[model samples]
Target: MCGGEQGCIETVKAALQGGVACIQLRAPGWKKRRLLELANALLALTRPAKVPFLLDDEVDVALACGADGVHVGQRDLPVQTVRDLMGPGALIGLSASNSAQIQQADVAAADYLGVGPVFATQTKTDAAPVLSPEGLATLKALTEKPIVAIGGINHANIGVVAATGVSAAAVVSAICGQPNPLASTQQLAAAWQAGVK
Candidate 1:
């Protein structure tokens, strides 16, 4: 659900089958109309499965597909503005790079926060510096918003991230570009569960 490039749909299907709680479509390379089409199709696929669908940086498409949420970066739509547009009940998430930003964020308007790149990642070439474990620990103490770790996350290191007490991990290339997406997704999901008592 991260990459709208080739193999994205299949990757999403595999993750859903492997028990991802939510999926956010975050590709910005596609045209608005095309993204809308993909959002609609993903909504159809996820609606019956009871999985929540989220959109990144595109409120119109999110609204068009009746998506469960929309993730807006700090530079993108303001959370308050998005809250106004989506109304109550629709989830709105914000991207945060550190504890200061997390604390400063009007989290009252957001349902969650995308906290990363926990490790350096190529998924977003312009991503800020990677947040070390200590940084994650700091952020964890700052807020109760379900902190969803993203960037450079995978089966190999997801458990460590989850152990920081974050609620979820948002994956991209790890599942999207894998030779065995379903197995990888299962492994990552299990890693997340391993963090629990």
Candidate 2:
């Protein structure tokens, strides 16, 4: 579940009930202390479920809370740096917006890549250009690293994104912003099952 909204921990619990494969803690504009608290609560939830718990762009938070990993973007620290900080077995996901970015990323250091604002999104005000399904497919072909399609992904279009063979779909408003996060997650999971990969 994506954060930056009220009652995010509750939303995360509901989404977990619907069988989300993983959970990422991301609340923009919040203080580190609050983020750490949220991450700790999520760790409590995710550990029992055996779902990976990831922190977005905060290596310190991830390290402090012992998160499964951290997801970093192009402007953030390099993937290698994060790997060195987290050491082996801790996951690292890097953003790869284009072929060049994909080629340049240290795949051996990163466990996955968060690629694209696959559709137009309002959650991330500064999201990259929409990749559509075709564009997503193009990017997916550029790398062997597991690709998690982020930005604007939701139940309505998750199937199409899945058809592009993205390794996973990351959402914000789709599940986290839903009144019924469990239902949203169930729908998204169903759509994901239809993907070629």
List candidate 2 segments past 4 Å from native. 1-6
- Tell me how candidate 1 scores on lDDT: 0.85
The digit string of per-residue lDDT tens for model 1 on 69-112 reads 89999899899999999999998899999767798747779998
**90-125 per-residue lDDT for model 2 (tens digits):** 878888777888888376689998998888999877
Q: Candidate 1: where are CA atoms >4 Å away?
A: 1-6
Clashes of 1: 0
Each prediction's Cα lDDT score? 0.85, 0.85
How good is model 1 by TM-score? 0.94
Candidate 2 has an lDDT of 0.85
